[model samples]
Target: MAWKKDDLFLFLFIFIIVSLYPCHGNFSQANNKQPNFRNASSFSTMPNSPYDYIVVGGGTAGCPLAATLSKNFRVLLLERGGSPYGNNNISRLENFHQTLAYSTPTSPVQRFLSTDGVFNHRARVLGGNTCINAGFYSRAEPSFVRNAGWDEVLVNESYQWVEDKIVFLKPAAPWQSAVKDGLLEVGVTPFNGYTYQHINGTKFGGSIFDNNGFRHTAADLLAAGNPPNLQVFIHAPVQKIVFDTRGTKPKAIGVIFNDENGNQHEAFIKTDEKSEVILTAGAIGTPQLLLLSGVGPKEDLQKLNITVILNNEHVGKDMADNPSNNILIITPEPQNQTLLQVVGITTKGFYVETSSGFGINNDSIVTVKNGNMSELKEIFRGGTILEKIIGPLSKGNLSLVNTNVTSNPTVTFNYFAEPEDLRRCVAGVSLLLEIAKTRPVKELMGNLSYTDEMLLNMSLNANINLIPKSGNETKSLPEFCKKSVTTLWHYHGGCIVGKVVDRDYKVIGVGNLRVGDSSWFDVSPGTNPQATVMMFGRMMGVKMIRERLSAG
Candidate 1:
């Protein structure tokens, strides 16, 4: 169905009702008064003994940092959102995606903004966006890692350590074969055992260990071990960073946060007499928090009447993001297949190099195939080879509008800003057209009426508008292409590495403050970033420990 603005709103409203109405029943069944395990009070509240290290944002990196750091130090983790321990929204994987989309506009889960003044999405809850994301995992490409100025030995060690800690796996069942066939036909290839592969013009592998299910997230990782030394404080928004200026070099001593009940409390990091602070609060939160604490651009701080501690102009400037657009192909039949049932193809020609020297330097392309008939006939049947020849590619980006800390900043992603991106997407769509011509898929296609108008409408908002349109043209391919554009939910690059933070993940010019999250990515990984974020988190953890030990 062509999703008109009204249709989109209706779908969203129904989704919201379905997701929220059921929560009341679940909440009634569970005791609400029981102290939430994710809150600061659930753990030791002895403010008398300050923690050895304090980590902010108990989501992707924060959770692991707390778990790993607690092995040697008393770690305090502060989270602004409530825990998803027994939340139904997080239990089932499919429900996770649905709930996430519904919560994007209103919930304080993740931050979202539109460059065209249209849409915005962001997660403000614990586990950050991970609690409600499509759980695709991938590590950074070796070349990408090398560019970060780290030694080969360190990168290898970090990858190996992270892989083990996260238990990375690959998809092996028939579903993988089916999806692979579909993608091969389209020309999009999978990454060759690298996280930072060129995606502009290549066919590569999609990141997946098993095509049957989603990977684990931060909550799953932390809950599995339940380490004793770590304390998680959820629903406590950090108001400001308390810095101790007594010494020549100012150090972040503690944090002040407001709980859900409107009560404020202060927690100090023992810092072993000189402890360090790690901010894994994600791209949006990390920058916002820093600005709120007067650590951003001097001019902007002055305008807000806030005192500037660090005059770093680049604190929130070099904002970048992978442009993501979604292309939905209507299958002739309703195949009882989930997203996991699909195969991923990573083509080599998709990624190209930009003037920038960053690895996977230019735009990234991802093509998802929809073959309902083939899937219905054989649960694992890879679509006919022709299907791969024509598939659609969606593109988007991460951008910042205003630098206000209180308001959720705009995050407009220019989904298909580059002509090359659209060319690749058009090719993918052509491939899908071929697949529809096949015998099995043809039967389904015959029953379905697909008009050029519908296709244009669907593709337009998907952000694939490279085709030119003439005022007099009807529903020509070029005209249809000219009318389409879209946005992606994957938010990244507000505080990229090398440009924003130093090689060790430390915010430059700031003493003892570091960031370890998706925001630290110098460029958006051409693929899903769950694994990459976790790996970087582990790497940051190692760096933090080493720095603290050396200082002590």
Candidate 2:
């Protein structure tokens, strides 16, 4: 056949029209607005092909881990919630509590109140707590890396990698400036400037939020990933890990996940010999899922009739939570909005931190009692200091329920179970009171007494007692703490490295299975922990790369 000039023109015209058709109806959305991501809404649409790595829970550690692995491997990152972008309640600092307290099924955070009555929230969305928490970012103390038996140089590199992606310098707001001065006056001296190290005394740390009020969360790490080789699915909750026990030791071959409408689908490792199933679900979620997958204390699983794959006693043990008290001091002046910046770290293992903008919308506050001081109206409309006892000697565990996605693990947070913890709390309260009485604080603040109605609004505690203020003696602060202290949402020691997983984060008893995230910490890192968690994820990414290249 001979081609003519007019025929060529006609073919070119038709090709241009189709290119501008303005529809990207296929999974390979090269021209769609959000081309690289997929909203996993139906079971039939899931990719039947296997991947080199299947990451569960697209959270703080999971996002970075998946992103880093995608550089050389085909990856599938599964998240339970929608993207962090275009969510006002998540992107803004003022809406922190609103996102936490919301009960919507699609909410990025699921709020939980423990058996001990400590209110907390777990991450349900991408970037995990970095998307919803206090936003105070600090690297783990060097002592922590040494204690965890990690190479310090490699740990430092991981910190740099994370900080380069999501962390930002937060300027001290006006209220935070006052807090810094107050900390200085109370002997928390030698400010460490705006750095991310967990140094002693008063210091300002990094934040996920930038100076322009935009959150650069762990989700941003995906930008550095190989888009063609990576597939991210949101609104797809993982149900279980399918096993192939034909081998001498059982091996994880694939996973079962549910779409948004509750239809189930399965995804498995690819033909690569190095393929793996990694779990970066947080402390509670990782252990709970393992228990559901027939791994945990054999007695507990047997009681629930769950088949036992491995009787790992350390799976859900040694759970610890940081307990804190919210000390509200009604101020004479309207306070400026402030995020977590200025921190007063004590040598006695407590943190005295301050925050403003207590005047969050009424919807964020769970209860609104107009009779007392109008909880519907903001009551803590003044300066507030959070006295957190970070070093709790008590321990707890996560118990299993029936095997259903809707069933939440029973979390037992036995806070203040040790007398030493109570004593440390008492010392923390005394230090906070001392700071409150300082000339700088007293200059603008009023009497530091809690009315009965005011005390009722703080939090739910099992035991509470308070002695009336006397002219001669300090009021019973420890008794007040037993009634009002709540979890700081810092939990650790669920699946420790030595017992549950190897130093490389590989499950010792299972082939091609690994666990990361906050659960792998042997002990409480005594910090916000998001940075530590992220750094460890980066380390895993680096290790996988090194090992693969070395094997070749």
TM-score of each: 0.72, 0.85
Best-fitting candidate, scored by TM-score: 2
* Per-residue lDDT of model 2, residues 209-306, tens digit only: 66656566677777668887788888888888888777787788888888888877888997455899999888888888888888889999999888
Q: Against the true structure, candidate 1 has what lDDT?
A: 0.49
lDDT of 1 by residue, 1-552 (tens): 466764454333222211111000111112222222456543445443677777888777776666667766777788877766566656454355455445432353543335544343455666565566544444455556667766666556755554543333333223234333444444445423322222332222222222333334465445422356667777777888887766766577778887666677888876544566788888677877777777777877788677777776666554544432222334333323233223233352222110001011112222223212222112111111111111112223332234443366645445445565556655544554443343543443345544434433433433222334353322454333334322233456656566668777777766667777777665554344555566666666666678678986
Candidate 2 local lDDT, residue 206:
77
Q: List the residue pairs that clash in candidate 2.
A: none
Compared with the true structure, all predictions reach lDDT values of 0.49, 0.70
The TM-score measured for candidate 2 stands at 0.85
Candidate 1: 10-residue stretch with minimal lDDT: 352-361
